[model samples]
Target chain A: MNTNNSGHSVDIVEVTKTFANVTAVHKVSLNIRKGEFMTLLGPSGCGKTTLLNMVAGFETQTSGAIRIDGKDISDVPPFMRETGMVFQSYALFPHMNVFDNIAFGLRMRKLPAKEIKAEVERALDMMKLSGMEGRRVRQLSGGQQQRIALARAIVIRPKVLLLDEPLSALDKNLRLQMQVELKELHQKTGLTTIFVTHDQGEALSLSDRVVVMSRGEVQQVSAPIELYTQPANGFVASFIGEINALPKARCQKSGQDFRFEVCPEISLNGRQPARLELKDGQMVHIFIRPEHIEIAGPRHNGANIVKGNVAAHIYQGTHTQTRVNVPGIGLVELRTKGAAAIDQAPLGSEIALSVPLDEAVILPA
Target chain B: MWRQTLFWVIVSCILFYMTIPAIVVVMTSFNPGEILSFPPNGFSLRWYEKALTYPDFRGAFRTGLIVALISSTLALVIGTSFAFLVVRYVFPGKNLLEGILSSPLIIPHFTTGFGFLLLGAHLNLNQTLTIIIMTHVVLVLPFVARAVYVSLLNIDPNFERSAANLGASPFMVLSRITVPLIIPGMAGGWLVASILSLTEFSASLYVTASRTQTLPVAMYNYIREYTDPTVAAVSALLIIATMLILMAANHFLGLRKILAIDSH
Candidate 1:
């Protein structure tokens, strides 16, 4: 990885925030590299926005410190912190025209009139809003207003650009379009960005590193692929995507592989993970994505085959999700490619499903 | 259709009943005769000319305008700060403070006038512009506070955060964002308070020793002492001035837009 080492890096150390009797953030520590796109992903009321606000200096942390570059900014006010933010509501000044809204920061800095006009024009051009400099904000659509909000923030060339779910107001198609534009904008400016969102798809797609937060603590901080493939815990796994969880499985080590008895008449062999230690007769749960399960032939030769009947077949646009009911084991959902599973595995038909050892993840029950 | 017709009839009747006295007074201002009468003998500008040139009437009109201007301006400032405190902060006695500030609007005007009369004498502040302006501010501050508070509530709180993050200091955010957005409400408050102060009579009558009577008080005293068309002419001019002020205010800040605070 080529990490840029020469820009503003935010270091949040053991920060805890509380509002009256409720603790919003608890001892959260994170390091965002210079010029890296870091995302805080969580549900509502999970303190993601609170953490972003603390970094932007809108809310002071109850305890601990936040540093930008090598200097501590705990005492600095928001205006002095030199961080630009796009709010969730896209809070553009309704009284000002597009040019004045984007030129506000430059005017606040007391820049020369020529410089202010030049900078504002450049920002407008960059945001594809060059001809809209004279338009009132109230006349703009939601997408146009969103672009103006970004233009206003980026015109200042702040040390770190903070976005608080700036795309949440757009429609689905517009949201996808803006998501692509946001990634391109990040690459073009190469500014350190901290984004807060509740959408896991947005976090996984736009961020260099994703921080999954639950309640008031960070559950895991990893790359998108690592978070999807090797989640740190049950919360991270379920939050990132769908998975079939087989709890109450007993495991026994056999050489390099471990045999797991998932349920009555359903014994399966799997390789033990190198990082996790296991003992004989230990209770564990196995998680596998529905797409990883495959249909085995009647005379299957693999040691992972199990006999079950196709209970249901749900036809999605690009794929079919089939639920197979094993006599001893519970219903196992399998995703098969487009319209194929319906003809092959009709309802109430006997079928053989195979669970590959490498695709299954074993966790302590 | 019958209900609609009856509604229109009743509305027009009420309107005519409310406006006939003012129409009669305006018509008397144009009376050619010296005595004030509903139907004039002939049209003339003699009474308007006399009323404009009258020294006491001129002095009273000037005093009323100046006092209203200074007092309403002060009331706007104080009421806006009070609104900020009530909307944005939490502290002891907040509700109590609001209740006390709004007491003048609830209490009888004559009772308030008598109360201020005793206070002014005790403080040796009678017959002074300071006391008059102070009293007018106290009387009209509730209107300003209510209008400004409604506007403040309608403003999205994120706008301030966005400004702060864009490198604006607290004072700059206030001057650049908060104040400009609420100016419509402030203008509404100023106009209502100033008009009310200009027409104030009971409070000024009780407080003014000799030199500081408002226009309404001077008009009342003049009508009691003598009978002529001069007073009607003065009333006509005051009405025209008020109409002009309303037009100017509407031109600057839409009157309907400012009063639409409750809808927001």
Candidate 2:
């Protein structure tokens, strides 16, 4: 047995998976760095989980190759792939207790009893389940069962660890706690983890790099902050966070600067007419974060200012959200910190709105 | 509440109806009078001793045990493999294959016996123990296959896939995971098949040789040739033996587990 201190990277090359007439995953090529926590993030039926299964050799690629440590393993069965997978449902052996669950892989490898006991105990300790060695998996809480699953997978000391929506079954608080534990566990073990989840927040929070996919195709692959700040397209941006999308017809451009054409009925200073060249006559979307738009101050010269009536105002304890009705623009949301006064800003009251041009993102038609 | 009451009433009626004949058989077997009768003057163990001394009775009992054991074991092996194929693999004419395997259950036993007799004649296997065993296996195969197949279908294929992914070979998954999980269903099917083979009469009548006369066939011949209380005694003994075997099976492997598999 080769006991090398350095870990190996997983390289998936143009892998595609098709079941009968339906294609689950299209040609997806991605190189996961050694010891990096990479998440495949997409909605249901987006093939993110399928991609993870292909890496683990649970599902074979219809076409293309997969390699671990730079050697082709597309034809290798799951048992010979040396990859550990934690399923979404945990899939712990119902007949086995915590100790046996963790020791199963070691036993399969025919390791000595003393060594298996030591490894199982160490795994239980790593998962903070030291004294839970004898408990049946069904008896454990959801979070504890999830930890047992992790312990079972990691105890095998696999070169690659594949997690398919591991935290999805846990309650929100436990999910968050496991997220931190998983990150720390990955850092300590450096096992080249490949995780799959539909939740963008999970991907952004836990991954070293996030691969965003849609309709069985990869949209973008980048660091979490880059994916958040500099999204490759509208799909990634909308899926990642809430954004107010407005028609680009309501926006004008000057050299490199752009402005919105607020309703003509509403009076505003320093507002320019939308540029003809920028308006392709087709509907284009402009996304602005709710926090980027502010209630204008009197006597302040603000760019892109709109005079509108408050259609509705909701006080949300920490922040107050108001929907202002501009004549042609319908309703635009404005979020402000610090609770607004209970008697302040009644519905249909006139107010001036200002949005910084830099904060608005122009999306393709 | 009314429905539950009605269900219990019907169940009690059916249970009473089924037990009446068994009660008569036991009562008649212990009759003090020389003749088998519904109401006995007094109880005695003389008929049991007389039934034991008869060579034909002892030989037939031994034959039934051998046939039932061999046939049930053979059926279990074949039926379980058929179930595994139907559950795990996709092939052409799968539905047709399933129908053929399960067809024995629908066919009349007399027709099956006559067909087997013809086949045995063609194969020069007339009146042989091998022929009787083979026919018995065929008679009970559908029950075993259907029971085990249903259990295999209810199990998630992902369990096996998950096992394979965790470094278990296909054989390892079958032996360690799949087989252990399905053993309850297999045992239930095997028990039913064994009981069926033990009491088999119509097929055994045609296929069994003089040296291989099973208990049921031997009892039929004894009743036809001689009108005596010894036949009732032997019938009672067979029923008691069957109940003992069933109790032993239930004690070792839970009846609840087997019934649960059938329910699913």
Candidate 3:
């Protein structure tokens, strides 16, 4: 975390937006550093796209301020903001040829004829669309048209680039490819980029920092690994990845050590527990990763283990997922390595699930 | 099955009844005999020649062409602006404005014609080409505006927003994107206005001066005074001109596309 301030790339200061009587965004303040790729990730109507639009100046925030490169641009219209946007639908001009569409901004600025020609050629080359200059936009394939739209936006050399779910319309394979290409493009251009998407995978894979949002509020903003490994709250934990939460039955404390009686499946081992303080008979929640549970292991004394019948085993190619039913404890999921056939876990067969006591994290219920 | 057959037969008969007069007009235009009859004595081109050579008919044709051209172009400009304003902006009384603009379509042409005649007479503008053109603009503006309004509604506002985000000014978006995309609608509106202006009778009869008589007014005058095949020849010529205009419109801008916009 290089926190030694590089001047803020794009600053949204207490920005609020409202539509009619409904509030779309409320007092959202964030600072994006220069050359940083930040994504606003949330579901539809969560105001992620609304915030992006305000940054692009296509929308006016009800209050607060927005600035790009330290200049207040809250009142500037979209054309004067000098920001480029890639729309979700790749709104290429249907009547214009590819080269002309890319050159539209330069033409609007009344650039010299020769300069416009050279710049359009350079943009086409940058987008790997050199030979597609003369073709009409509608004749191009989806991916090719998407590139043309990118070229059209970047040719102006804007201060910031805003992408609103730019890869959403593509098929899965092309979407993956585009994600890599867009990340590379961001690095190459070093432009302050604000991407808006509802896809957690896209936000995690491409952004330098991801801002998770829910119900029109920022939930968390961190690096992808940090967000996944140590979520700030239960909502973030569930939203970022899968986690199995178990209810705590009791807790005991000695000096500075605290121990909790979690799921009926787990029991404490002999260890020095002489620190921390917690009351007994207190209910709590324990968070554990599915892969931490060990199946078909040799029995160890005093280990956190539970005996249960294998209710269901699903074959998922790289790993086998099993649902085990323990009496009075309900069902728990365990994902083990290798194929289901190789694991040889039959339905209704008795099995023992074991996990290290230290691996489970107890949180306030 | 029998009822279906009967319904289709009745529809076909009605269609034939509507087309019979047009058929008779064409037939009389080609009649070799001088008299205008239901069935032609023989087929010839002499009536066509007579209609073309007649000085009054030529004058009236020229007047109608000029009036139609001026009225249609002016109406298209004013009507499309109104349509865009109504569709895109939020202003007080927008609905009222739209209703007032489209009122001409609902009002009978004769009522509009007589109202305009009385207004023009009081304003010392009666029996003049300017008044005729003004009245045509009023009569045809509603059709043009309604056609263009439908087209504007179909276009996604995001397209304009994308253009704005790409550094295009409002004027630039209108010229480079909006106008070109809505051209099919504009053409349809222009064609309808042109046809209406060309064949305008009730309004033109009230406003047209003796020297500025249009084709329909001239045809009315000629029919009342004479019973000759030349009148049918003139009517046939007018119908042919209309057909040619429609074919040209279709060839350049597909009629299906224009009709689709208008219907919406």
Candidate 4:
């Protein structure tokens, strides 16, 4: 029914899912643009998978509707929904060869054998699995199975592509490689892909737009960069990446700038062009990323300097994470580049930390 | 060294305890003497010929085969569907249904047979082939259901979901995915049910009349009346047949998988 080379758009409106007494997904609605690669990212039990299942029609919503290309299909059964999904287990028929597995959807549609074979071959070729057509599903390695699963889902070329943690099964290196292949496949097919995963890294790297969900509700739906930089709440801030939260920091409005006082001795200055949503002396929480904070010069005295002792230094290859315990603030983590910080900032050494509000978010306490 | 020797001696004694009766029956069946005796005057196939050629034995054997075939097949279909239901959906009284079906295992075959006999008599279908087949189906349904349940449990639920998501109806998912994947379990269950139904003596005795008696019931009758090695011959044949079928099942279907002994 779809003649466009680009994908059919999906509109999920006020979708809520409940299992018995437990609500897995609350009244959450999202609009996915045609050919856009969207990911539902959350921790386990955050209802990301439930929302994806609703879109694929595996799990129907308690209320509300899902539309494909402006047509509502909430009451449609999964088989009639015509949305292709790649499960977490791959779910390739263990009894069939790779070719048959990929051709299964086409065969289900009663497509001509010649056309089905051509499409399967084309999919296999795109996934770089040309010679694996005759191989059994169990024979393929984890990465190859992943590729075949992708090939199978995309070969159908349905209204939307659903992936349920497809890369979680692979080892780290293979997962990274498959992530690239997945991105390229999306570009080639232009199918409106709805990817569901709990890993923040995969969500950040793969999705055009990432939906950060928590506690059965959509915390924020934005591009990956915006999700990281401008998280709507405390949950989104901590979930997307590591950040330090200064709880109950009383804010004061002073002309064009804002100074947040943590204690009599320690204060943070907000010069980041102001969200300007806070009132004078409003109790708020400040969020600053690990990468933005730097070890301030000891002689530096002013609004943004805070005294702390180096608590720990975790040496990662790219960047060493330095933890500082400010008296008013709890353990504040900083991602200082290279191993220089490890030698420079030893344990229990008093350090003056510079807190940058350039990317910090302040929310009402 | 003494501990190892003691363990081996104990194992050998247990093995002898288990298999000596079968060895004696197999040996006794070949006795050249008309009367049943072990270490016979000379080995002869006379009893085997008699066991094969006797009219009543022949008729009983036919009945047993028919009953076993029909009952096992019926059990296979019912049990596989029931297994699918148990694995897929949860409803009220599910455990109760499972308990009632599997009660035949611990209910004593004679009691089940007696119950069936009473039902058949009340329906005025006493000792008929249909009644006997129905009895065997109820008796063997539990084993078939358990085997298929183990198999269905082993299968990834995603396979069916994946099929349904791929534009296949529930029936298509059953036909294309569920049935094919659990076929080994079905075949294994069917074979076991057939064997159990064939050798079933107490139930067969209660359920069948003289005209529709099964092999084991006929063997029981011959044992009481005639002092001959024919029953031994029949038993030897059955033992060998069952052993071969089980071994073949183990080789082909991985009996350990169906029995869930090793689980892998």
The DockQ-based CAPRI class assigned to model 2 is acceptable
Q: For candidate 2, report its TM-score.
A: 0.88
Candidate 2 lDDT, B41-112, residue by residue in tens: 788888899899999989998999999999999999999999989887899999998998988878877778
Q: Which candidate, 1 or 2, has the higher lDDT?
A: 1
The collision pairs in model 4 are: none
TM-score of chain A of each: 0.94, 0.88, 0.87, 0.96
TM-scores vs. true structure, each candidate: 0.88, 0.88, 0.88, 0.94
Worst 10 residues of 1 chain A by lDDT: A1-10
Query: Once model 3 is optimally superposed onto the true structure by TM-score, how far is the C-alpha of residue A29 displaced, in angstroms?
Result: 1.1
In terms of TM-score, the best-performing candidate is 4
Candidate 3: where are CA atoms >4 Å away? Answer: A1-8, A245-289, A293-296, A299-314, A321-334, A341-343, A348-365, B1-20, B254-264
What local lDDT score does residue B194 receive in model 1, on the 0 to 100 scale?
A: 90
Question: Which of the predicted structures, 1 or 3, would earn the higher DockQ when compared with the native?
Answer: 1
Name the candidate, 1 or 3, with the larger lDDT value.
Answer: 1
User: What tens digits encode model 1's per-residue C-alpha lDDT throughout A1-365?
Assistant: 11133357899999999999999999999999999899999999999999999999989999989999978999999999999899998999877888999999989999999999998888888788889998978778899999999989988888888999999999999999999999988888888999999999999999999999988899999999998888888788778877787757888887677888887788888877645788888998788889988888656677888888999999998999999988777888899899988999889999989887686666787
* lDDT winner, 2 or 4: 4
After the best TM-score superposition of candidate 1, give how far the Cα of residue A194 lies from its true spot, in angstroms.
Answer: 0.6
DockQ, each predicted model = 0.49, 0.39, 0.44, 0.57
- TM-score (2 decimals) of chain A in model 1: 0.94
Ranking of predictions according to DockQ: 4, 1, 3, 2
